[model samples]
Target: MLCFRFCPVPRLELVLLCLVLGAARSCALELNLTNSEKATCLYAKWQMNFTIHYETTNKTYKTATISDHDNVTYNGSICDDDHNVSKIAVQFGSGFSWIVNFTKQEPNYFIDSISFSYNTEDNITFPGAKDKGIVTVHYSEKVSIPLNDIFRCSSLLTYEENHVVQHYWDVLVQAFVQNGTVSRKEFLCTKDKGSTTVAPIIHTTVPSPTTTPTPKEKPQVGNYSVSNGNTTCLLATMGLQLNITQDKIASVININPNSTGFTGSCQPQTAQLRLNSSIIKYLDFVFAVKNENRFYLKEVNASIYLANGSVFSIANNNLSYWDAPLGSSYMCNKEQTLSVSGTFQINTFNLKVQPFNVTEGKYSTAQECSLDDDTILIPIIVGAGLSGLIIVIVIAYLIGRRKSYAGYQTL
Candidate 1:
């Protein structure tokens, strides 16, 4: 009896200990890159300081920097030849993610871009920014690394701004690289060095532009998927542009699946893709099975947060957009828009959607949207007419050439 009582207590303590350890685990900034042959190409150790300059309600500028050691967790990493790009991502704070992309250029691979996205409803806040949703900043120039040498650029800072807030990156990067067999050599970017080392490469800080910066454009199209355990359930590729109205003012938002947070339920006959925005409070897109073998977008739900801390809710459940048969996808390459309400609208461009019944983690077939059929048919008819005319002209030219050859007794 004593063994039974004490054994349960120890098992409970073990379970609680595991939970504590799991919660205490944090992410490291170390990353690796490999080529298509499964050979190591690059090794990087990096940490970043993101500082945001925002104007408070009293018209005073204030700055905040993200703490790297506090609440940062590594999301995932990918290196593929499909785009010749390598990526590693981390989620910090509540709803903020930072992704770094690297690209190969002949004998060297360099940092291609860096993207930072944050939800307004989360920990990070841009006080005076006119634009909302996921805010992304891209580096126009490359940060390169040489072969067999470690590129250390600890002094280079990048500055960018949107309509309201200014953003800055103070990144410390040390990457070892090579052309064939990857190796590491110490090369510094700092001005102070000992007598034994070679001359260091210097980098200047990027200056702020003089002109007023336009709002950053969000990604409108991407291929996105979701899985349960080891099985794939949802696969879709679509372009999404949203128009939202508040207080008679309209704002356009671009939806990039990579930067947006995704959560949904996938059942046998029903599936959903809920995209929650850090800028917007809550957003949802619903797709359901209909007509036995067909599925269509059935609803849209959103709760827009206002400036005064109030919520504005909008939804439309009577939508039947983008209907396609099971095991196939619906495609429309033309531009189209669907009106959900007086205050909400969704626009699509070069669209392709498959929300249910995917097999082998891929779309099995395609069913073009009816609205796009007429647009495609007109181009096909015009091309056929032009081809027929060209054929007639070619035949006439051939006959003329034969007659001339016969008259001259030429073979």
Candidate 2:
């Protein structure tokens, strides 16, 4: 009851792709570039601490910092290899970038120091600032990155008003075929470790037991969020098998639950329920009811195959949530958007899977449904009417007899 909700090829897909490409090619993940080591769990959460020091040429400056930590959920690391990471890089937009340089020691990666920077003439603006000024930022932070299974990628992490609430997990692919590969392309190396070529490596803050307090103000943390135009809280596609044409199969779903990026408990969302089977042809329906955060498809059209390969399509009868009496409506509010991609569902049979995002106008042959409530309702109404009439006639006859008997008693 708690797992069915999900979306389409929107910005979410693009973001995942970017994460894949950037993670595969990012310089900060030196292990990814190392040929001897294999990189797995490339797509996982990285707990980042960002400190932005914005300074101008004329000596005007301010610093702001933010921690990706939310007290409850722990964002994990990058590798499964027992060998610790020697380098960690967190790249910001076009300008700002951060890296923690470390050396690969006997068993663990020894962190030497953390480095980060942002430099721009006029782009870095704070809470209150005049129009034009050059700004330079040197931010340093330490964080942990978690590891994920080979097929799964923790694509998005959302918090409501900066509070970490659970039950909003939406992992994109539960199983991956690894359609792409990561390879180390090129390298620029220096013979001497201390040569001027490694010039950028500099001394950052190495906190000792006792250090004098500095009066510098803490940097302001900025807002970070991920959402679509409709503000879907969380979505995932689970147990989905695709690209089967010859055999009967199970189906796919697109659950677009509505929320401002916050999902918890039973909040049902709009969905495209589809089930495709070689024996059952195809089935598709689009719905936009209220949003619920629980997982599992409330109702799906299914097909039952007999011993002799005979098949029957499931309709209103098999559905617990979608069960409506014969001729009665679906009893749930439908989605208003006429979007072609707004809804989807699946089926069970000899294994075939297909998708239809086109607008559904009327029920086709595959959508033919049946319910026995009306078949029994007609007989019940007639029997009830006849029973009521018979009782009324018997009461009238008894009254007439009483009137007739009153005259005899008077005589």
Predicted model with the maximum lDDT: 1
TM-score of model number 2: 0.21
* Residues 1-411 of candidate 2: C-alpha lDDT, one tens digit per residue: 112112212111111112222211211111222112232322322233333333334433343333221112111212322343434444445344445443334322233454444334324333333324433333332222111212111222222111111111122210111123422321111122122222211111112233311222222221111123345322222222211111232222221112111111212343444333212223333333322322222344434321122333443322323322221123112211112211222321111111111113221112112332356777889999999999999999999999999989999
Q: In order, what lDDT does every prediction score?
A: 0.56, 0.28
- How many clashes in each candidate? 2, 40
**Which digits, one per residue and each the tens of the lDDT, describe model 1 over residues 1-411?**
011111112111100010111211212244445555545444555434454433345533334444333454444555543455666565667567877777766565677776776654333455554334565655454767553456554442333433212122122333323453545465554422321222211112211232211233544687767777687788766777777665443445576554455556688777777664433445677888887888998888986533222346898999988888888888888777778887788777777767777678877778887777887888899999999999999999999999999989964
Local lDDT at 46 for model 1:
44
TM-score of every candidate: 0.42, 0.21
lDDT of 1 at 111: 71
Quality of model 1 by C-alpha lDDT: 0.56
Best by TM-score: 1
Worst lDDT run of 10 residues, candidate 1, spans 10-19
Segments in model 1 whose C-alpha atoms lie over 4 Å from true places: 1-218, 306-310, 374-411
